[model samples]
Target: MDKLRQKDYFLFASAMYSQPISCSSLVEQATSPFVSFHQRLGCFHSDWHQHEWGQLIYAEKGCIHVNSRTKQILIPSGYGVWIPPDTDHEIRSTSSQTNIRSICFPVADNNGSLRQTISVFPMSTLLREMIRYTNRWNQGPVDEAQATTFLQTVQGLLPEEIDKAVIVYLPSTTHAKLLPITTYIQTHLARPINVQWLASEFGLSVRTLSRLFRQQLGTSFSGYCKIARIMRALELIELGCDNVSQVATDVGYESLATFSNNFLAICGHRPLQFIHSKRLY
Candidate 1:
């Protein structure tokens, strides 16, 4: 393995968007397997992008918001996000402090037969440390063999299934009006949002928008919005926002009491209880 220069790294990262999709350098790095770790503090924006290779993104200290088409997933620590090749995605830091480590590797083929969406799974402490270690050792041959072994071990230990609560799919749609509405809901999750306002904004009748939600997303508009709120609440709580009431209000619930009730219904626990249980784990 050879340490990549700064220019080499940037050029490699850019290949994810280039045509005739290539990942040779990334594969060599993963096979020779020099891992590079990065940490970004404060809010940052990545424009809509696609990669020719698959990426594993883990939040080491805070939370990240990933928007891929109409579906959005909030990734907290102890969880890693998997993005398949060529899937357009963008990420943002939602917490005051956020740290993310990513490993990019080329897929063996571009068949598109397997899953082509984001997957979130639990990461053990050991796996986290191994990733960091691999990043530290990404260089010449002296550390190459050990790094390769560690990479294999980490990949082997990765969870095969995603948490049901952590996966959301954005259904592809052709309806022109629905795109802006979906994007608006995701960006303004903290604001009080209602169907009538959404309907009016898109020049859609409330009945029309409601039907569209069912037809395209396979869920009621309110149900989908609640799921979105739950995702936001999860991110806020993970960032040490201990005020459950404030978190609830921030996610657009009218009352803390109502938020608690709804959170229990969807997540099988109240907000505080979920946080407590996760801490124990």
Candidate 2:
């Protein structure tokens, strides 16, 4: 993190750690075939755990970070992650004022492609509206015939919608040498980071460091840095950072046009458009 944002990030991290809530009551109940819960959170962390049922976690206002053993996915505002039953995972809030809506499903409730895997997908306008409508169920014992049928219709639409999954996941690694490097990159995204600088700072030769990133993280050093910058940029935008130029610099970009171009390439929307869309939610 840059010096300018250090205090803000510290507060975010501290608040996130200080406030943790359990979803056991809502997730473990057998009384409902599907249950939905909504809560507004101030950047918090839920340490590693697994649910007895599958969960679709949506962020209506901010961003969520979901981590499994293999990968870490970022669900930006207006997006959601579907985690399968019994899948060990951890969730962390990425922005203050994260409004989370989660719908839990029994093991037998789904049999399509959406079952059995963790997927981060975009929530279309129609799906977002439908999910908002379920606020009436409010952590439901949604066993009523009409309510169940409507929710079923929502569940039925998921498989098709998931085909539009966005690639917002950060590349992760377990290598002893690279783990700290990746973590540092995430925390210091505003710095001018490169393969040569990281190689020297970490006491590894340039060739070896470059090779490690490709072999272990499945991306080149520059590629991983690009992904990290764009992800941080999105999180900042979701947190209500409205100045395009300021956000560009906050993520280590020197050129506004360059930042905007990269943001469009990864997110399928320009930064300003993304900022405008956040207001709709």
Candidate 3:
């Protein structure tokens, strides 16, 4: 196993120890056929870790943010993310009242085709109810014949459901100069954030800033802004800001029509459509 980063370790320790009994034991010593953890938490972050079993992380209320080295995925409320076994990643609760439900699947039980990549899938009523039922075995070997069989049925339904995954990953950067700029964009999503303005604020030339974004983040400033706004809109909707027009304005869009078009282009769903879908779960 790879060593945990220093900052990752500190954040993980702080969050895990706050629980009534350390849930760290559940994650680290997951020898059971299946294990699940359901907790209502405020803002939370986990340390870098990998499991021998594939993991399904769901947020019943807010949004779940899953970060890997290469990508950052936002799993909105009523949705879940599937992490393949042996994948290095960390999970975060992006909203204040996040209800996180995590279920682990042994290698033999997970979808073979999806065993190598992470995916975010919308949870159907059947699937969501099935996962919620598993809250029965939060600390578990879950090896009983009936329970194991039920879990296997859920595993079987995954590959088909995961095909409907909505890929909404916000751009991220670790470059020293770009990191602060990215952070600024996230906090100021309601502002008119342009490359020229950012360059002036960060004391870099516009050309230099554009080049840095292209090289490090593989996107233009405007491109990243669009992604950031839409992803933030998703988080807002998950947080109970259900007005489409309000969400559009909050994320820097002056026109509701434009916001709807961009939301559709990016995630193949209109803002209202996404909200309705979320309500179904």
Order the candidate numbers by lDDT, best to worst.
2, 3, 1
Per residue, candidate 1 scores C-alpha lDDT tens digits across 1-281 of 32123322433444343222122333444544333546655445566677666677777766676778856676766567777777877776645456778776545453342235687755656756666665554443446565556555555554343333344234445578777888788667778898998899889999999999998877888888888788767766765667788788778888888899877876556888867755643
Q: What is the C-alpha RMSD of each candidate to the true structure, in Å?
A: 9.7, 2.7, 7.3
* Model 1 TM-score, all chains together: 0.69
lDDT of 3 by residue, 1-281 (tens): 22223323433555564323333457777655667788887677777777777788777887778888877888888888888888988777645567888888675742576586888877777888888888887554455677778877877888888888775786567789999998899778887887887899899999999999899999888888898999888867765767899889878899899999999987778888888887665
Report clash pairs, candidate 2.
1-187, 1-188, 16-43
Q: Count the backbone clashes (under 3 Å) in each candidate.
A: 2, 3, 0
Q: Which residue pairs collide in model 1, if any?
A: 16-52, 29-33
Per-residue error at 257 for model 1, in Å? 5.4
lDDT over C-alpha atoms for residue 236 of model 1: 63
Residue runs of model 2 more than 4 Å from their true location after superposition = 1-3, 10-17, 107-110, 139-142
Q: Estimate TM-scores for all models.
A: 0.69, 0.88, 0.81
Cα lDDT of model 2 by residue, 178-219, tens digit? 999998888888878877888899999999998998899888
lDDT of 2 at 54: 73
